[model samples]
Target chain A: MSEADPVLLNPEVARPYLDRGGDLPALPLGPEGLDRHTRRDLLKEEMAIAKEFHGGAMWPYAVAAFSCFAVWLAFFPLAIMGELNLTVGFVLSCIFATGGYVTSHEAMHSNIGRPGEKNRWLNEAVGAVSTIPIVFPFSMARMMHLEHHYHCNDPVKDPDYTDEAPNALWAWYKTWYNRQPGVDGSIHHYKRILAGMGTPEAARALKETMLLQLVFMAVLFTMAWSGYAIEAGLLWWLPRHIGLSYIRFYLSWAPHHPREGKTGRYEQANIFKSRLGHVLSMGMETHMIHHLYPGIPNHRTRKAYLALKPVLQQRGVDCSAL
Target chain B: MQAAVRGLFSWMPLLFGIGFIAPLIAQIMQRLDIPAPAGISPILFGLLIGAPWGLLTVVRGRWL
Candidate 1:
């Protein structure tokens, strides 16, 4: 099949099992325990498939960054001439943040260029421009993130999992204070992330966050002393927060929560099921496919995900909505 | 659905005012014996409350 076949490329049309739901069958745990060589070959095949979607041309990163900067410039007048249009400013900031974030994201995966010293410097530069520097040390984030991929939804281990603790008083408070009757539980769950970030692990994350903040502050101060601080903050600082917050919110939670029959952590659910999910998340919405094959790059995931959905469903896994 | 809409309308304003507003509202709602809904965060709550204020600023010609 051609690489760009609609059926192959689109998860929505290819994976019907997510929408047509019933109980899934159990996944095979290496039938009869194959020999080492056979298993190695299978793994190699999987890795090859995963690598097929690896790396996009670097131009998208430049394009995204420039577009984001233009948008921020357009909004600069609103922040300067008007009375702190918090909403528009905030929304605009979010856009900036997302741009910064996406660039940083590409850098993390070394998608901007070849791997090594050159790539490292470029990645760090991109990350610095994004205003979230500490996350640039991909070795650290990759270590944590890889663990997250391996044990997604494992409450105790997954950095992304923010479900309530069963026995904790804090958990009780969360349920009482946040759990609304009818709306999707995303807001409550997201609150848990915000609150949880205050915890020890989050404190660690914050330390890393602060390092970047310090660098950002220095830049701001330099601009201010140069008599261009207000312009700099408008052009850079303010918009960065807006974009980052929106992108973080948009990217982080939507793929996981609001699914049916999902309960405690370790439920092994794929929550991105709709066309909206795919579009809004920039194709990250084929979540079940992601969990099944974490090595698959973002671009090629939809097709691979769809190809495996039927098998995954037969194994009793809950595919996402779309 | 009506209850959902009512809850959203009520909460949206609170959420938008400040980043911490949602958590504060969630805290208060818990204390008042009111049912708090799920899936909302303090940040988003702040955005919700902030949106209208922004619109008002625009409407009043305060935003240039």
Candidate 2:
């Protein structure tokens, strides 16, 4: 099958497909019948099969999960008071910060609360607050993430395309390189895109980003000046850098490697086995399911992906890596 | 705001090293009782090392 054109996945369409599932037929679709269907048909069938796994107000999970960030934040004061060891704090902070993106990712897709839904505020709140550990503003992340979805692997338009590299080691290095001050990747690239958009939403995101950066620096400076510099570095700054690298590697680079020419819905993201496993990789091993049915929550993607693997194979997606 | 951002970033790396990292290094050196060269203050010694490293990282985009 040829690579499908890169087209926007409509959450409105994704919504119906995300509803609670109906009973599956006693037998799965046969190989002969699947072969007769096009990729789009298989995509719909896959969505139908996985629909059972996702729905309901995810705000509770979002709220409960926020304690992870709370705990990470608390490590700062705890370390300062000598109640917690800096080495232990640093390690836990890294894990919490690494996991922060997935919670915010759900909110980016409105899985926690769909637009116009009553709990939508909670979605935005979760999205906004969850990534403080990594110093990423939700407004910027949401806008750029939506763009990545619409553009997928379009080298020019995809904000995440910078994470692409020829090999694993370079991919890891690109994550750090992209964050360098002079680089036109990462937040700097997002700034350029926002400036070009000139929309109210874009302007607001830019404003929020600037404000967040200021706050981050202010806190670091304050902590340092107050003799808590070690606490600041161990609890927040170093952990953030580590988290960004890990998140960029697994969530951005790994799923979409060799991103040069591929732009299809099925071609943009692939399934891969992570040495860190599904949970440690932050549910990104099955990221193809996320690109297809974004409404599926992170915790459920593994099961959903397994159930949908047959259809994904039928659609000519490369499942060999998994 | 653009100017402010630019201005802030111009010295951000260096200032971060001086204000945050240097103090940490100084504290560590003091705890370990590592003598600063020429009897320079521990904080000064930390700044001497951390500031240049930060400057290089900002310019070269890597700590090493």
Candidate 3:
């Protein structure tokens, strides 16, 4: 190829960049992509294979945990020094930050590590660290996500979708967990699950969390108060919005928008056959697999999808439009 | 023309890092009492260097 030859935005090259770390964003299986009958059949037939893709690892969790810190660490000072342009540099930070969040989603599921406090602390820690760029509280997001999975799109129940999904970029526009109002801002749901905890201890922990938050905010506002307006815009506020938008774009808007209001195995999610789809969302392009088999981790969603695809298609699942 | 646009988008990170990031960093260094080896509006110098670097990197990343 000549120097000026056009470069195709092919899968192998583009997918990695879009996927950030190895975790692919989950693509919906196809809104209600699988009928309940078919879903049951799939479970009976392919659940074993999907199960093989389950379980978690440690080293990958460390990479994802530390990488999130590394990205913010690098982006902040550069942003502080004005070494980064607001548009491009902030976007870069968003990309890395989104990667951290994506992996952190798995951490929420304990897919990248142990679950149920065997790995709960690690999971929550990674999630908390990852959200720094976005300024969301990790514990709150985790509890909300657990509900999101339980209700999926149950109107008035799944805190995420109280109203009808707008006839628009519906999925992408759904409110984030902690970003919304009128819920447990301090992760009371999970705390409730933590049994036998006395009131005084709970009060103490809550007091500390609030204090830490107050101090953190005081420092940021102090800096911004002192004419780091552009710096704050570039590093903090801008990247937080960008990172959240990026995730919603790939995870919510792209997959859910196409097929909202569909029911069972046919819910408002779909699989994208295009490399760009896979590239943009990672394995999330196979979202149905994750929804149906939440136990399957990020790296394994695709593998399970490929494994069950034949069975799914045989039962009239929509695998068309690639 | 299309290639150029895509190239430009792909290369923004590099471009901004040089033009915007570099200059601000210089100013920050000066604020921290670091030696500049001379006097200057490091921000302006940074912009001058970064803009060209950003543009060229965009081209290289996209095409080559």
Instruction: Rank candidates, lDDT, best first.
Output: 2, 3, 1
lDDT of 2 by residue, A1-322 (tens): 3223212133443343346564432232232222223545766787689788887557666765578878877887788788998888999888878877888888899888889988898888889878888888999999999999999999899989888999999999988888887788888899889989999999999888888888898898788767787788888899999999999999999888879887867778889999988888888888888888888888888888888888777776777866
Per-residue accuracy of model 1 over A95-172 as CA lDDT, tens digit each: 565555556555555556545655556655554454342122333343345555655666555554543334334433
Please report the candidate that would top DockQ against the real structure: 2
lDDT of 2 at A244: 95
When only the first chain is scored, the TM-scores of the models are: 0.53, 0.86, 0.68
- DockQ of model 1 vs. true complex: 0.03
Candidate 3, CAPRI quality class derived from DockQ: incorrect
- Candidate 2 vs candidate 3: the lDDT winner is 2
* CAPRI grade, predicted model 1: incorrect
Error of 3 at A319 (Å): 1.8
Error of 1 at A224 (Å): 12
Q: What are the chain B TM-scores of all models? A: 0.34, 0.80, 0.48
Q: What is the lDDT of residue A14 in candidate 2?
A: 34
Task: Give the alpha carbon lDDT tens digit for every residue of A163-254 in model 3.
Answer: 23444344334434323322331232333332223456444443443444444444454544354545655666556666776665566555
What TM-score does prediction 3 earn? 0.59
- What digit string (tens of lDDT, one per residue) describes model 3 on residues B1-64? 5356434435544645553445555556555767454465655555565566656655553211
